[model samples]
Structure formats: structure tokens, C-alpha cells
Target: MEIVQIVGFGLIAAVLILVVKEQKPLYAFGIAAFAGISLFLLVIGKIDAVIAVLENLSERAGVPSIYMATILKIIGIAYIAEFGAQIVRDTGQESIAVKIEFAGKVLILVMAVPIISVIVDAVMNLLPTGG
Candidate 1:
């Protein structure tokens, strides 16, 4: 039911944007951006719930809190960057949108470095030592 409402809202927004785009392109862009933001906000609670579940599972698995936090931040960056890129793309800025996505990928890789190092260390420890 909630998904239906969301879809309906999105469809209505799309129609409104199309109708206004001919006479007022700026308004059409505004409509698309607003719709994207509104939809993001609506799903925030669900996102929080998922994060809570992941945190609990990580704790149970004895994963360090820092690792979990870093993972969550990476996820957040990906989502926020994609959202921003979409909004900019709506304004017909393809290059800016691509740049935003590129930045997000770079940031995610940077954030992942510590985790990667830890994994490499663990793997090295598991290997046979040279006599």
C-alpha cells in the first residue's frame, strides 16, 4: 500500500512535470527535484530501521563498531551522491551529475581503505610463515 502511494505520487509528479515543461522548464525541473527529495525523506524511516538491524547483526558477529560505522558512512555517501546527481541531472547538467558520482566513488574507496587493510592483515596472518 505504501509503495502504491509512492508510485502514484511519482506518476502524478511526472505528469505535472511534463505538462509544465513546455511552458515552464524551470518549474518542471523544480517538480522533479522536489519529488525526488520527498521520496527520499519518506523512505528515511525504513533506512533507519535497516541500519539498526545491520548494527545489531554486526555487534552480534563481533565486528568492530568503527568498521560498521565506516560501512554505514560509505552507504550514506553513495545514496546521497546518487540523489544529488539525479537532482542535478534533472536540471540537464549531465557533466555535473557524472562528477558527483565520480566523487562519491572516490570517497567510498577512501573510506574502504582501512577495512581493506584489516582484511589483508588477517589474510597474511593466516598464511604459512617462511622458515
Candidate 2:
């Protein structure tokens, strides 16, 4: 299975990183980052396939392209921020990792505002208004 290969690759990288870490901390970080990116690259095609399926389903459901795009962007931001945070954390920067996550949350919130407002409007329309 592909998962087995990924796990094996990850385990090998982990061992290599651990071995190098004692003598070369910087290289250890580099190894961790490179491994993380390589793993991401391996799954990128699957990510695209998922996006395509979601887009197809959204179209069938009559969802606006803008909403779908926003949702995808939010997902992307979360993944990228977490990835960056992990890389920074590998370098022993916990504070910076936290900041990166915080920034991602803020950006997600900003991107979500329009969708939230649309939902609120829909709900308000369903309520009875006093004449």
C-alpha cells in the first residue's frame, strides 16, 4: 500500500534525523522539513482529486463557485499554516509556531465572514417580521 511506503519513508527519515541531530542540529531540521515536504508532494495529486470531487458535488448542489473557492482556500490555509508551524517547531521555535497557527485562524475567520453573513441573512428571511 502507498501508506506503507509513506510510513516506511517517514520512519527512515526519522532515524536519519535522529542520528544527524546529535552532530548537526541544523541538518536535522533540514531533514525534517524536507521529509515533510516530500510527504506533501506525494499526496498532492490525491488532494487535487478530492478538490475536483468537491467541486463536482458543489455544482450539483447549486452552490456558488465563490463559496466553494472560499472553503478550499480555508482548508489550504489550515494545512499550510500547520505545515509551516511544524517546520518551525522542528527548529525549536514554539512561539513562532503558535503565531503561525494564530495567523491562520485569523485568516480563516476573515475568509468566513461572507459565508456567515449569507447564512445569517437566510435565517433572518425565514423569521416572521412584524408589520
Candidate 3:
């Protein structure tokens, strides 16, 4: 069912792109944009399902829920950032798209720093102090 929807969307997008090449470029762009968004929305549900499975597995393994949540957040950030960047690029705003990508990387780094600092502190604490 999922595969069928995906293939159908692709076919529609391709046909629209070809048709729009001559008649109405703007509408073609709109169709392409809608197609991309529709595909993303379709796959988003699968992503949620995958995350649920991951969370359940992590819980069974006694892994921290915070870790699982953080992982999912990172994935979400990447997906959104990439999607926005692509749209910007599609509209011929390459510079803006570059900035968007940069911002996304910076945001991800900011979110990751605390986890990194915690790990560093833990490792440091494990070391024996030399009097």
C-alpha cells in the first residue's frame, strides 16, 4: 500500500513536470512542490512507526528514554531542515538555502553539546585523582 502510494506520487510528479514544461511553468512548480510535500507527509507516518519500534526496543534493553527521544529529535530536525533547504533551492535561492543548511547544522550542534559535555564529565569522573 505504501509502495503503491509512493510510486503513484512519483508518476504524477513526473507527468506534471513534463506537462508544465510548456504550458504553465508556475503551476508546474506548484505541482512539483505539492508532490514533494505529499510524499514527505506520507513517509512521516512510517517514520513515527519506526521510532515507536525503536523506543520499545530501547526500553526492553534498559536504555534511557532520554537517549531515544534525543535521537528522534535529531532525525526530525534533519528531515525538516533538509526539506526546507531543498524547497529554497528549488526556488533558485541558493544562498538562502545554504544559510538554512548552515543554521540546521548549528542547531544540531547546539543540541548535541550537552550530551557531549555530560559524556566528557562522566569520563573525567571515572579517572583516579592524583593527589
Candidate 4:
């Protein structure tokens, strides 16, 4: 029911944006932004459950909560960076959007370093010692 309303609202906004963009392009951008935020807000409610499941699975697997949290943060950064990049692109700033995406990728890599090290060490342990 709610999803239907959100989809309907998004469709209406998109059509209205197409109509108004020629005469009032700024207004169209505003409507698009509002719709984007509204849609994100609707999805945020479901994200909580997803997060809970991730947390539970990590605990069951004996994974450190910190690593799980880091992964979650990385996912969040990716989403926000993509959203920001898209908004920049919509404003005709392709270069700036590229920079934003690049920075996001770098940040994600930095955040994964600890997890990467842990995995590497575990794998190395699994190999028989040369000595």
C-alpha cells in the first residue's frame, strides 16, 4: 500500500517535472529532490530490519561487531556518495560527480583495511608453515 503510494507520487512528480522543466527548470529540480528524499525516507524504515539481520548474522558467525559495523558504514558511505554524485550530475557537474565517486571509493577501501588484514592473516594461517 505504502509502496504503491510512493511509486504513484514518484510517477506524478516525474511527469510534472517534465512539463515544468522547460519553463521553470529550477522548480523541476526542487520537485525531483523532494521526491528523492521522500523515497529515501520510505526506504530507511526497512533498512533498520536489514541492519538487525546483518548484526545477528555477524554475531552468529563469530565475526567481530566492529568489523560488521565497519561494513555497514561502508555501505552507507557508498549510498550517500552515489546519491550525492547523482545530484551533482543532475546539476551538470559531471567532473565534480566523478570526484565525489572517487572519494567514496577511496573511503570504502580505507574502511575495509582492517577486515582485509584479518582475512589475509586467517588465510595465511590456513597454509602449512614452510618451516
lDDT string, candidate 4, 1-131, tens digits: 88799889989999999999999999999988888888887887888999999999999999889999999999999998998898788778999999999999999999999999999999999999998
Q: Per-residue alpha-carbon lDDT of model 1 for 44-84, expressed as tens digits? A: 77898899999999999999999999999999999999999
lDDT for predicted candidate 2 compared with the true structure: 0.95
Worst 10 residues of 2 by lDDT: 40-49
**lDDT: worst 10-residue window of model 3:** 67-76
Cα shift from native, residue 48, model 4 (Å)? 0.2
Model 4 stretches astray by more than 4 angstroms: none
Of 3 and 4, the candidate ahead on lDDT is: 4
Error of 2 at 76 (Å): 0.4
- TM-score of model 4 vs. true structure: 0.92
TM-score each candidate.
0.97, 0.97, 0.85, 0.92
**What is the Cα-based lDDT of residue 25 in candidate 3?**
76
Any idea what lDDT model 4 has?
0.92
